[model samples]
Target: MGGNKVAIVTGGARGIGRGCALALAEKGLDIAIVDMLEPEMARTVGEITALGRVARWYVADVADHARAAVVVGQVAADFGRIDVLVNNAGRGNPKGILEITEEEFDRTIAVNLKSCFNFIQPVVPVMRAGGGGRIVSMSSLNAHSGGVTSAVSKFSYAAAKAGIIGLTRALAKELGPEIAINCVCPGVIETELGNSLTKARGPELMKGIALGRLGTPRDVAGLVAFLATVEPNFITGQDFIIDGFQWVV
Candidate 1:
């Protein structure tokens, strides 16, 4: 909330993650951006620094628990405390059940679900030590409504995202008033990854959205930033869907 408070956003190099990083930075929180993309990560750091907030970048795969621990520890050492953790790094595999291999399924679960645990586990103690914290995980509308794309329509991605909701609830209970954990499930956002998937699926996918247009990363980021900063600390363990009413229709 203050300029001195520190936040970490995983996969903050680009897309939805980048939007969240910028949103938080604009709010005056120093940021630690973790991503596998070195150049892009550095660019995000530069942007945050230009915002007059301290910014640091850590390059590592979110799925690697050991590396995540080290990176988070380094962040704690650098920032003195971590006030918010946004688990925004994830991968979507759009293959039908018959077409999806076990390895691919595992990778999807690892990135989308396990990575949340990897980042949260280390940061929980840091947050508790700092008195309290906020955690926002990136989820997908496909987790509730089935995916329209032929690739992910099989169910693995949805299942993995659903798992994220479960984890958010369980962790929220475990952390109690000390930390708040929540998930944001976005629908058909027009990020580079989203556009690629939409192109892969064709125009019919766009027509299905009640809004008649795809969502954007900023649309989702706005909600994420709100949940992270606004606090009487009552909202926890909830999953907010930003689908432009697509699910309603």
Candidate 2:
């Protein structure tokens, strides 16, 4: 299993995942996109291909454990090696504790938190077999701030993102020397999923941010690409906050 570097980016159909995938491809890594959005995924694959890199899309839910294993196997078989795994697939939960159902809470955890475990377990072995690799998971500033009052993601989403931090720390120890793992916590980023919140709070939110503006998918993608491609990496288990210093949240 040997070729150019390869990366698997979950939720790579659009938004932040798309940015990460394109950034990695620009860094000369083949991209394997995992997402449920067919048209968007196809568009992203074409974009990566246009960058002169191999690009493939896998249709699967990130929260499915068995499916994650299957997809990882297929990626290894198709790409011949796994160099990076970006766990970026997640959904926001706007419901409060009082209104959310038990199933809804569980699904939020499964999709946002447990899904990391599902992919990491299978990808870790493949990465180890490939000699060594890097893992950058997408957490959120909500993990630290508990989100603002007008935020679209609330308690359940924050909890899941926080779990990603814990998982990154623990796995850094468990998979160390063979694999380097880290997570990133981005503040209010302007993406399709996040536009509603941004449109409503853009001006108000910018006032609190040191940068005096909201963030973009490329803003987060740059950090992820750095963590993935940084040579002789000495960093792991750390959560890099790319929030432009938003003091309000």
Candidate 3:
């Protein structure tokens, strides 16, 4: 709401995270971007600063809880308060069950799910201290509909994402009137990750969507921005699906 609210977006260097940072900055929120890629993170920081908002970049792996805590502390020290947190950093594993190594499975779980815990845990106190805050985590349509890959791979991703939704609901209830938490389940988007997956799966994958087109990062970013604002204060503990009605038969 206020023009001066501060927000942190994980993986803010590129793709959906970049889109979200710019969108929020346009709405007048000072941004603190966290990403592992130092150069790209700096680029995003530059873009946010150019928009006349305070933008700081931190290079840290969101999956590392201790490191994430330190990064969050630094953000609070610099910004004075954090009104929003976007857990947008994530990864995908497209390999079939037999092909996916334990290392790959662990990495996906760490990046896609555990990062939420790392980011949210530290920020919760800051938010409560500030009176309230909004948190949005990225889920995926594959979580519900399941992936086309082998059972083990699909199960792992789906389980992690489903865990995100569960976390959102439980945390929303725990925080209650003080903070709002929600999850966004995106369909195939036109990000580098999305493109690669689509190419790997071939054109047949597109046939499932009635809209006949993949989503854009902007499409998902718009929803994230809306949730961050005061207008969505009444909304919490919900999972909003942003696919092109692909699940519709």
The TM-score between candidate 2 and the true structure equals 0.98
Question: Which model scores highest in lDDT?
Answer: 2
What tens digits encode model 1's per-residue C-alpha lDDT throughout 1-249? 122889999999999999999999998889999999999999989988999889999988999999999999999998899999999998778687888899999988988899999999999999988889999999888788767444443488788889999999998889888899999999777877787767775476766777778888889889999999995668999999897777431
Per-residue lDDT over 1-249 for candidate 3, one digit per residue giving the tens place of the 0 to 100 score: 223699999999999999999999999999999999999999989999999999999989988989999999999998899999999998777666787889888888898899999999999999888889999999988778776652223666777788899999999999888899999998888887777776665376578787888788899999999998857469999999998887531
Worst 10 residues of 3 by lDDT: 147-156
Task: Report the C-alpha lDDT of model 2 over 167-210, residue by residue, as the tens digit.
Answer: 99999999998899999999988898678787777778889999
Query: Any runs in candidate 2 off by more than 4 Å, and if so which?
Result: none
Residue-level lDDT for 74 in candidate 2: 98
- Give the TM-scores of the predictions, in the order they appear: 0.94, 0.98, 0.92
- Angstrom error of the Cα, residue 94, model 3: value is 2.1
Of the pair 2 and 3, which is ahead by lDDT?
2
